[model samples]
Target: MITFAPGPSKVFDQVGQYLQDAFQTGILSANHRSAAFMNLYQETETLFKEKLHVPEDYKLLFTSSATENWEIIAQSIVESSSFHIYSGSFGKKWYTFAQHLNEATGSHKLGTEDALDVAGLEIDGKHDLIAITQNETSNATEVSQELLGALGEKYPDKMIAVDTTSSMGGIALDFSLADIWFASVQKCFGLPAGLGVLILSPKAIAKCESKGESGRYNSLSFMLENAKIYQTHYTPNVLGVYLLKRSMEDHPEIQVTDALVRKRMKELETVIAQSKKLTMLVQNSETRSKTVMGIAGEELFIKEFKKAAEQAGMQMGSGYGPLKPTSFRIANFPAITEQEFENLLKFLKEY
Candidate 1:
């Protein structure tokens, strides 16, 4: 079946060949400390910097998942307090996780209707770190890049950490706007859910150095020290890193993928606008997420729609969190072909 599940969704068509090649070449069992593994790590890091436009000065590290980055940040980066700003369930969960680690952690929940407004946001002076969810996967709302730029300017002293899990490879982000940017490979990277990619600015590294809290085995300092020599603090998913490198090589240039995603998102928007039975869950078009589209309708209609799509050989994502019964989600990732998207749109029209 053609899967539309948000994460662990669709992998690149070349994944089978890459995996086969890895098995035949013994890449799956290569020692993490071997020269071969170091080369592989450097190659992947180069691809991220050149193709994905990660800043040259920033350091890239890998983790088990993006969730782990939260703990790393709370323990190593936030010295005094952190202010979490969220618009959806995932963002709220991250905030709660930070609060558990630091008692001084606080949060600001933006109103759902005008969630993208960050111009008038007031952050406490005591909070040294500002956490922003770049893309709210649970609700399909995105914080604008322009808004992030504004925040960086307004609070230059406060370190900014952005969670770009669902939007990372699908969009071109301005790396200078935030101090720390992280994402999991499962969504836009077109890979399985095993590895997380983190890009940290020099400011973030300095914060970790000054704080010097070695909270976990995968602490920022340990990861940074190992990453300097193109290695990890512990054994990592070698297969996941290989797949990510292959996927990046397949694209070569991020603009090609970004343009395609924007084009397809527009097409999908047009189709959704023309449909009588479907409406967008995000009322404001400006704040709507291009990577994940959430559609809302009558409860029975949504149920029947998912059933129809499934019967037609499409496995779409169920709405996340509380919107499950009245809405459904569509992943607009690179692995999905133009023909597949057109076929899904045609099916939606017929339904």
Candidate 2:
């Protein structure tokens, strides 16, 4: 089945052949620190930086998943105090994690409130970090870059960490404004699960250093120090890393630019606009994610839509959380073909 599920949706065609060759070539079982492995690792990191347009000084760190990055950020950056902004289900999870941390370590969380209606946040220097989920995958909401810039500028002293899990590769992100940015490869990188890419500015690295020995595993400093030697603290998902490397290489910037993605998004906008029953979940176009588009239909229509798509050998995403059964999320990441988009539209029209 062609998976349109939010994550683990589909792998690149070339990536599959690459993975098969990987095992046959013995690169799958190669030592993490081997010369051949490091070459691939470094090349992957360099390609990511090039494609993502990350600043030269920023460093890319790999982990098991975005969830693991949550733990790493929670343990290392939250310190004794923080201010968390929550807009939707995923944001609420981060806030809940913070509350749990508060109870466990007696740490303080200040100005914790739902980010959906957050108009004005008063920032004091007391809070060590300010957490924001760049894109709310659950609710199909994204905080705009202008708002993020305002928050960062308004609170120069507050360290910022953002979760760009669902929208990273499909959208244009300004990594300079955020102290730390992380994403899961499954959603936008067109790869399988079990790998998360994290980019940290020098400021974020310095904050981790200030923590002073954050118990080995979840420490950003530890990852940074070890990554220099082309290694991970634990046995990294070497296969996933290699696949990610291959995917990055396969989709170069010269051929697939953000402008191309934006153009496709515009085309999708026209398609969505023409559909009477299939409206968008996000009211504001400015905040809509280019990669994932949530469609609003009745419960019966959603079921019909899914059934029809599956019968046609296509998979579509279900609305998450509060919108489940009322909507379907359509992922139009770069890896998806034009024919697939047409097929989805055809199915929508029939239902």
Candidate 3:
């Protein structure tokens, strides 16, 4: 069935052909240390940097999942305290994970009604790292670029780490806003759920070196050293990396993809706004996520809506966390074609 789930939601129509190419070229069997594998790795990094507009100085590394980056940041980057700003479950989980490593960990929970106003929020001077979720997958809320820029200016000394799990590939992000940015491939990258992309600014690298903590195999220093030569600290998901490279090559310009997503978002939002039975979970229009749209309605209506959509040959995402019974989510990733989205919108309008 066609899927509108938030993650692992859809794969590009050409992904199967790319997989076949990988297998024919024996890339799937190549050793991580082999020249062929290193070339593939370097090509993937180069494409990601060029397409995503990542800075030349920033380093790109891969991990098992975005969750792994949370552990790495706590273990290798934060020395005294880490402050998390969150409005959803994943962000809360990241803060709780940091608390286990640093006793001085703190958090700021943004109210659902308040626009993300980090410039007005007071952060403790002792907090060395400021963590922000660029997109909250659970509630379909987003942190505005203006707020991120304001935080970067206000706290230049503090490391800014952003979680862009659901928004990364489909949207264009200003790389200068955060010292460290990470996302899993299962979402917007239109790949399977085995790899995470971590981009680190030079400031982040210095923080890791200055901290002088190095033991884990995935530590920043170790990963950086291996990444310099286009390699990983351990064996990685070669197939997933190959798929990501192919996806990037297909849509080489991020701005073009971002525009497509924006157009589709406008279409979907218009339909959602006009729906008599459905309402947005994110009340503020400015904060609603472009990549993942969350809709709320009566329990019976939601159940019937999902059931009818499924019967019409579509699989939609159930609402995350506490909103599960009253809401549902739809992914607006690049992998979803305009025709497919139009079909879904038509179904919603008719339902």
Candidate 4:
């Protein structure tokens, strides 16, 4: 099937070869502490930075999944408390998780259809970290980076943690706008879901240092110490790392891919706008996610829409969270080809 399930969405065409290369080259069996593994990790880190335009000074850390980083952040990065500003299920989940860890954790839910209005929100001053989900995958909305830039300026002392699980590598993210950024690879990286990438600014690193040793297995201090030598605090998914490196190498810089993604998103907007039976879940164009397009239809039509796509040899993404049964999603990631977009667009136009 032509998969587009938005996260484990669509594997890059070359991943099969990368997997084979991993086994043939013994990367699948390489020890995490071995020189081979270290070199592979270092090279992948370099490619990750170069491809995504992540600052050289910014540190790239790895975790099991974006979910794991939530704990890592709460445990290691937030010394006092975290204030969450969000609009979707994933963002709320992060807030709930933080609150579970630190009772003082706070939240402000923005309108699902509005762009992030950081200037308007009354954020408490005592929170050490401000958590924001850059892309609300469940609702197909995004927090504009322009607003984030303004937030950073307003609270230079507060660490900004952004979860870009669905938009990372698919869009142009301003690394400097936030102190800590993280994403799981399955969505846009065109890979499996075993690994997550956490990009941290130097200020975040200092905060980790100030906390000293938390003695936790996934403490930023312990992870950073190992990461300095191109290693992990524990055994990692070697094949996943190798695949991410090879997949990223297959593409050009992020802007090139970002342009393609944006163009396709526009096409998606056009097709959905012209659809007699379908409408977008997000009304505001400014806040809609370019990578994940959630389409609303009658509940019956939603089921049939997915069924039709499946019969046509396409694996459409089902709706997430509460939107399920009435909405469906389309992933506009780089791994999906222009021809696939054309095919899907044709199907969409006809259906």
Candidate 5:
């Protein structure tokens, strides 16, 4: 069945072939430190640059998931405290998780529909790292580029980390704006759930060295040392990297894909606007996420609608967190073809 679930959401149409190629090429059995694996890892990093427009100065590394990176950031990067700016569930979850590791973690909350006013929000001097979720998957909201820019401009000396879990590959990211950027491949890369990409600017790398904490298995310093030789700090997700490389090899560059995703987002807005039964969970049009769209309706209607969509051979994303009962999400990743979106829209139009 066609899937529009936000994550573990849609596999690329070529994934079956990719899996076969992996087996045929012995990618599953290759040693993480072997010459072959090193070659594979290096090639994947190269593809990330060519396809995603990641900056050359930024260092690339892999992790089990985005959640793991949170711990990595806490252990290796934050010495004093990390201040968080967020609105929805996932962002709050990150801030909460940071608190367990660092006692002085700070948070600034905003309303779900509120626009980001960066100049007005005061950040404490003690918080060394500033963290924000680039996309709020739970509510289908995104942090504005202008706000990110404002933060970078105002705090040029501070470290900035962004969780771009849902929007990384689907949009054109401004890598220069943040010191640390991370995302799981499931949402936008059309890969499975096991792999997450972490990128660190030279400034971020300097923080890891200055903090000088390398005890954790996922420490930034350890990950960096191995990455220099095109290796991972631990037993790697060999198959996942193989699949990601193949996916990136065939994918269009970010600018082309970004245009398409944004165009389709507008189409979805039009469809939702015409629908008597649906309203967007994110009311601010500018803040609506380009990769994931959350649409709301009556509780029973949402249940029936999802059931009907499933019967029509489409698997819709369930509502997340507090919005679960009244809303459902749609994944607008690159794997979802225009024709597939049209098919889903046809059903949305009819229902």
Candidate 6:
């Protein structure tokens, strides 16, 4: 069946084989501290740096998933306050996690969530840090480059973090503007779940080292220290790492200037326009994510579309938040071919 769900969507043929081969070679059975495992781990980090155009000063750390990274950031980096910029559920969730962490650690009253009225809102440079989700998978919303740059200018003293979970590999990321940028490989990377890629700036590292009194495991300082030598403090999803490494190796090019990405987006726009029963969810094109498109239509249309599509061999994503009743999502990642898209459109038309 075709999977148009946001993540754990698809994997390259080679990535699948790599997992099978790894199991056969007993690489999955070897100790995590062994030289062989360390070499593989280091190579994966190197590949990430090359593919993500991650700055030399920034460090990369792999975790279980983006959910775990949220706790890591909340526990290690957020001590006093964080001005969270929220446009969707993921961003709101991160802010909630920080609030809970603050209450648990008693780390000086944490900050409140700022309403994401992009035009009227201004970044208060007073907070300890600024957090924004680069791409919102749930709503197919994105914080624009202009917004990030403006915030950086106003909040030079505060560190900035981004959740790029759905945008990495599918878009060009400017890590220079944000202190921490992270993603999960399952979405745009065309791999399975269980691996989250996190990159940290020097300033973020300093904050972690200073505020990491929250304890171990979720400590960014510990992750950073071990990452220096290419390792994780705890046992990692070794097979997921192998698939990530193989996927990166398979597509070494970092810059995602694919004409096809643009072409498919345009095609989707045309399709969206023609369907009277359906409409693109996000109001702003500037903030719409290229990787995932949120579609809102008649509830009957969605229910019928979902049921018919599944019978005809398609798997569309359920809505993430309050929109679950009226909205669905479409993934336009690299692995989805033009023919497949045409088929999807045809199915939609028929249904």
Arranged by lDDT with the best first, the candidates are: 5, 4, 3, 1, 6, 2
- Cα lDDT of model 6 by residue, 211-246, tens digit: 755457767777777777777888988888887787
Model 3 earns a TM-score of 0.98
Model 4, position 80, has a per-residue lDDT of 90
Which lDDT tens digits does candidate 4 get at residues 76-102? 989999999998999999999999999
In model 3, state the lDDT of residue 320. 93
Go through the candidates in order and give the C-alpha RMSD of each one to the true structure. Answer: 1.0, 3.2, 1.0, 0.9, 0.9, 3.6
Query: How many steric clashes between backbone atoms does each model show?
Result: 0, 1, 0, 0, 0, 0
Which stretches of candidate 6 lie above 4 Å from their native place?
Answer: 103-120, 123-126, 212-214, 349-351
Residue range 26-124, candidate 1, lDDT tens digits:
889999998888999999989999998998898889999999999889988998899998889989999999999888999988755565456677888
Q: Against the unseen true structure, what C-alpha lDDT does each candidate score?
A: 0.89, 0.76, 0.90, 0.90, 0.91, 0.77
**Which pairs in model 6 have colliding backbones?**
none
* Candidate 1 minimal-lDDT segment of 10 residues: 110-119
lDDT of 5: 0.91
Model 4, residue 3: what's the lDDT?
Answer: 86
Off by over 4 Å in 5: none
User: What range of 10 consecutive residues in model 2 has the weakest lDDT sum?
Assistant: 105-114
TM-score of 6: 0.90
Give the C-alpha miss distance for residue 133 in model 3, angstroms. 0.5
**Considering summed lDDT, which 10 consecutive residues are worst modelled in model 3?**
111-120
Native-to-model Cα distance after best TM-score fit, residue 269 in candidate 5, in Å: 0.5
TM-score for each candidate, following the candidate numbering: 0.98, 0.91, 0.98, 0.98, 0.98, 0.90
Between candidates 2 and 4, name the one with more favorable lDDT.
4
